[model samples]
Target: MPQRLFIDVHIVQTVPPANVNRDDQGNPKEAIYGGVRRSRVSSQAWKRATREHFDTTVPEHNRATRTRRLTSELAKRIVHDTKLEREKADRLAGALLTRLNLSQGKKASDTAYLLFYGNAQLDTVAALIAGQAHDLAALDDEKLAEAVKDLPVADAFSTGHPVGVALFGRMVADIPKLNVDASVQVAHALSTHETQLEFDYFTAVDDKTEKEETGAGMIGTIAFNSATLYRYATVGFAQLTDNLGGDTEAALDALDRFVDSFARSAPTGYQNAFAHRTRPSLIAVVVRDDQPVNLVTAFEEPVPSEAGIQATSVRRLAHEYAEASRAWGDSPLHAAATHTFTTDEPRSKETAEALTAAFGDRISFDELRSGLRERLSAVLEAQG
Candidate 1:
């Protein structure tokens, strides 16, 4: 609540019979909440899917690369930008990375952990090396340490975290100071109804031997479940802007991309077999002048309906949200949208309309994202 601004995204998406997220035993993940087992998909899986979507769809400079080959990746950039030989570039990158204390050994490729770094960060390092490449290449251990003694190795290398890193975060155990605090918090999506795990016993048939062969090429049982899931995430507006080094445009772009990708992206687990690519039946966006309020408890009792689980879940979510808003006082701004629901679903329709009206807008996804960006931009301008 100390932070004066936050964005909360609440969703109701119903996936058909599919294994979007799986446990170690290959069953659909589940959690016991409100004293009943419910189908669950981890926040990690969904975040990864959304990040992957951004990497492909968003601009290259706006995304970060997560990899263990940090040295090699940097060395390639140095070689390309500074025109240094691969071996020299590799050595320079190694020396600079050693300043972070992340190397296991003297080998240029040795790194303590995978790095999630932005392209701009790599360019800064390359520029530094280019400026002092000759001197750094010639210096011995003692003199080399003295020559680069004043470099702001930690903070300097940490600027310009890509949109993904700025929103999600990066941590290096050996260099904790360089870690970027995550501005967004994602909750593990859980079903709004009781979940029962099911298995699909499938057999692969070889094309060469078809009709006459009674034997199967491969046979196995894959576990899965179907559920109407409730997904929630909260973004700290202040932290998000700060994380981008006060670049409001990039911050706004990140917010827009995050909402779009998070809404459309689904985990790829067993997708070839299940093909459960589903859009949310309902989405609620709330911008508050206080801390985030998650509505996962809306389904604490689990909704049952002979007609449709999504319909029941939608009604429950709207009612619970309305009650929560009333209890907590009016939110600064709110919006809701849906991809599916019919006129016949009276309770669902009424609840959705009431909730939308209470939220102050019933806009499409694009409009919702643009409005959020405009609001945040105005806030930034006002603060400035």
Candidate 2:
């Protein structure tokens, strides 16, 4: 039973529509989940966030602090080599000051590039005489590989700098211990949609206990201000989790810790958006088996997720969604059904959603379409 990374990340928010937003090219936004509006946190946002928190995000976790440290040391070389005043050198590097934001002002120009090419001691004038600029990506991988053959590797056992980390994350090298096999198979894909359960609750505190449930309100049509979601992304210890060889538990622990931090802290710009703040919604450490198998967990002799060593991850998400629903007096933004996109060789859309339901007597395609048609007719009639 080899370890793998098998994950299914579902949206636990009530998806409100953007109702209307246009693409840069002025295309209508796709309405998902039966004519509902999409929120600012769209599928793309959720997917990106999920990947980032999953410890697989490339180039994102690079330390900004070090990128700054190197900026100054490199800038000095530029001025001394060119025999120019610091101001002129600054203009050449497009750096107002070494303290300027990495990408701000015209910084991130050729000075950083010069430093990268091991020209720290070499004067700017000499480097320019030998250096030429071109699209790095345009070169073939073999060619690029050949070009870097003589570049000195770093010292052994050194805790390398952030720039090195960034360089590796950027197509230079694979992220060490990252399960690239799973990532290549999945491409960091996740979609989110909300499913509403119309229920009548008699009003009672949940059994999680010790904590008080002040008010879990009834579901309504009001626009909820914010939501506290406890999202669970479960990947198995298998699916050939090789890139992370022997670090399955560590990876899972790190992922849970990362998500916990993310839940408590809102994205930078929107920290003040919500009135009532909630931490995590809830956190659960879901220790998984080497190979995850989906058995219909019918009332077999189960030991409460192995005496809580491997807690069931999803129960917390439900509690959080309920809490957000109650707190906001409305539904939170969530995605509904996700669909596949393809061209000529597309995945079969015919066997897509509503097919099973149609066959299982839950819903008929004709009936669903006819009902939608009738609604459209009613709108058209009113318009007429």
Candidate 3:
């Protein structure tokens, strides 16, 4: 059996009064954990934010598009690449999509569900259609299916996944062969301490109100809360390498981007009203040969924030990690951390010392990235 490898990331961040993620009722999401209500940011919200970050950081060719209008998008590509009439392109695209066993939506140009596809995969499909345009355009629906029965239409999406798709994965219920299991797992961020919901009540005055009019134009309330969050995520290095077609360099690059994006990306929910953008105060990455571990249990007994949440949270996390390492005897192959805390204050000094003692010496973010990549490269080579 091949060796298994995983990379685990732990973060401690503090967000001010903001609804970074909200439920249907338009309130900050929460969860009852450790027998108390804790501020929560769902994994879906963070994944969306991370994918958005990839739009700016990851290369265009290495990205995927998620939408229900796969037929329309592919039709446009067909028209562009083959210069076929819009009507002909639409028909051809729709027929090709049908071959994938994907159900159509109410409209012929839409798929029943959102399809996450890589740009390169779409290009391949478009090129395949262009090559067979003359024959495919002349055939009726029945004949077209027969002609493309053996064609590699489904194979286009079965591999060559973009980094985003590879990490997040895709599922096509109608065609089980199209499903790609996600290589990464993200945890819903939870506050390290108990939380209480708070609201802000305000009134907006009409700018053009008459001089005699004293009433406000609008009045309403918005729900929010502030907390020091503990965010966790893990990446299966073996699965990632396979998703990238066993390209170790690309796998390393993807891991590096995942780390950066997962750390820096913040959901834009109610961001304009709250401007709750803040960087993680501490980030720890551990590479292990065994299964991935989520240290969230460390906060099962909520940390008290009377002194300060961020510092206290950091200390508690360090202690939990130390105990886990000692109890499990599963010391990581490589461990490192990058923190923004300074040693000037006593609490901050204690937090820094604890982190250093738990996870080797503090290193710069760049150093952390390079070190992980180097270690991963060696592991991949050895496994090969």
Candidate 4:
């Protein structure tokens, strides 16, 4: 059997008063953990943020699009590649999707649900349609379905998934064969201590109002909270490699991007109001050959804010990691950490030392990225 390898990432970040993720009532999301309510940010919010970050760093060819407008998107490509008009191209695209058992929404331009598809996959499908554009466009819906039933339209989506799709996976409820199992799992981020929501009540004045105007144009209240969060995510190297068709190089690239993206990405909810774009104070990466482990249990007792939560949280996490290592009986293949404290206090220094003692090395963010890539590449090559 191929060796099992997983990369676990843990983060300690502090955000100012901000509603980065909110519930239906427009309040900051929260969850009760360890007998206390902790501020929460859903995994879906973070995943969307991470995927958005990928657009800036990862190559366009390696990215995927998640949208319900798959038909309209595919139709545009068909029209561009063939002489068919936009209307005919749209009908052809819809027919192709219908043959694949992907139903259209109430609007013909939209799919039944959001479909995650690779850029190259859509291009390939468009190329295939362009080959027989006139013939396919001339047939009625029924005849078109019969003519393209076995032309391998669905195969394009079953393989060659872009990096985003491979990491996050795809679910085609209508067709299980098109599903891709995710290689990464992200836990919802939670504050390390108890939190209470706060509200910001303000008024927006109309810019064009006269100087004598006493009233404001709009008034509202926004609910938010500030917390030092403990975030965790893990990526299965073997699964990622398999997802990329056994291409270790591509898997390594994806891993590198994942680390950078997860560490930097922040959900944009109410960002303009709170400007909560703080980078993590601590980031620890562990490469394990056995199984992935999350060290969040460290904060079960809730770190107190009196001694500075960010520094205290870092120390707690390191101690928990050490305890887990001892209990597991087998050390991880590799471990490293990078931290940035806003102040050079004694607690900050102690936290840094603790991390070095537990993780075995303290490096810069750049070093962490390069080191992980090197370690993953060596393991994957050896397994091959």
Error of 1 at 229 (Å): 0.7
**Poorly placed runs, candidate 2 (over 4 Å):** 5-31, 38-149, 153-253, 273-277, 280-384
TM-score of each: 0.89, 0.32, 0.95, 0.96
- Model 3 C-alpha lDDT per residue in residues 105-211, reported as the tens digit of each score: 88878889999989889989889878778668888989987776777889999989999888988989999998988999999999999999999998999999999
Q: Write the per-residue lDDT of candidate 4 for residues 243-318, one digit (tens) a residue.
A: 8998888888898999999999999999999999999989999999988898889999998868588889988999
Order of the predicted models by TM-score, top scorer first: 4, 3, 1, 2
* Candidate number that wins on TM-score, 1 or 2: 1
2 or 4, which is superior by lDDT?
4
- For residue 166, give model 2's deviation from the true position in Å: 12
Predicted candidate 1 versus true structure: per-residue lDDT over 1-384, tens digit per residue: 124678889899989999988888889999999889999999999999988988888667556888878788878978887787888778777777667777573544856567888877877776776776766867776777776666665665578788888999888777788888898899999999888988999998887885767888999999988989999998887788788887778777888888888888899999999899988888778787767888888899987735578877777777787788788776565454644554457755665565565454456777778887787767767666
Instruction: Flag the better candidate by TM-score, 1 or 4.
Output: 4
Q: Give candidate 3 misplaced runs (Cα > 4 Å).
A: 132-135, 138-140
Which portions of model 1 miss their true places by more than 4 Å?
1-3, 82-85, 103-110, 131-152, 210-213, 342-348, 378-384
> Clashes per prediction?
0, 20, 0, 0
Pick the winner on lDDT between candidates 1 and 2. Answer: 1
What's the lDDT for all of these models? Answer: 0.80, 0.29, 0.89, 0.89
Mind sharing the TM-score for model 4? 0.96
Total colliding residue pairs, candidate 1: 0
Model 4: clashing residue pairs? none
